[model samples]
Target: MSKFAKAGVAKKVMDEARKPQNQQKIKSAISNFTNKNKGGGTGAKPR
Candidate 1:
């Protein structure tokens, strides 16, 4: 949906894509996985 020819449609699509529920679900899933993997050396500095 290119905004050049259809601004309203593009705006609607982008708005839906940026919804709170969708963003929260994505962030929650990432955090859940990250917490599960919190341990020795997933992203830690070597000693």
Candidate 2:
């Protein structure tokens, strides 16, 4: 209920929401794996 506690909580939440440096690399790896192994895009394949 105090201002200090509220500020600390808000700062923690904001920090968590900020993307880390490795996020893009991780995302790209996942995307590449899915594409190579499972046809990653959103399209219907001919049977």
Candidate 3:
């Protein structure tokens, strides 16, 4: 797995990895983990 700190899409990658239903969607995690951006961390969204 890619380093969460290095990747800009930590939340997107981790959130996808944490779900059980995403077992067959491992590629999604890779995609998110590799995504590049200049934005800051994506903290939990307010309810």
**Which candidate leads the pack in lDDT?**
1
Q: TM-scores for all candidates?
A: 0.42, 0.40, 0.30
List the candidate numbers ranked by TM-score, top first.
Answer: 1, 2, 3
Local distance difference test values of all predictions, in order: 0.81, 0.77, 0.69
As a TM-score, model 3 comes out at: 0.30
Q: Give me the runs in candidate 3 sitting further than 4 Å from their true place.
A: 1-8, 27-47
User: Which structure is stronger by TM-score: 1 or 2?
Assistant: 1
Residue 9 in model 3: shift from native, Å?
0.8
Task: Name the better of 1 and 3 by lDDT.
Answer: 1
After TM-score superposition, the amount by which residue 10's alpha carbon in candidate 3 deviates from its true location, in angstroms, is 1.3
Candidate 2 C-alpha lDDT tens digits along 1-47? 99999999999866765667556666788899877777556567768
Task: Write candidate 1's Cα lDDT for 1-47 as tens digits.
Answer: 56576988788778876999888887898999988788666676767
List of clashing residue pairs for candidate 3: none
Q: Kindly report the root-mean-square deviation of model 1 from the true structure over all alpha carbons.
A: 6.0
TM-score of 2: 0.40
After TM-score superposition, the amount by which residue 23's alpha carbon in candidate 1 deviates from its true location, in angstroms, is 0.5
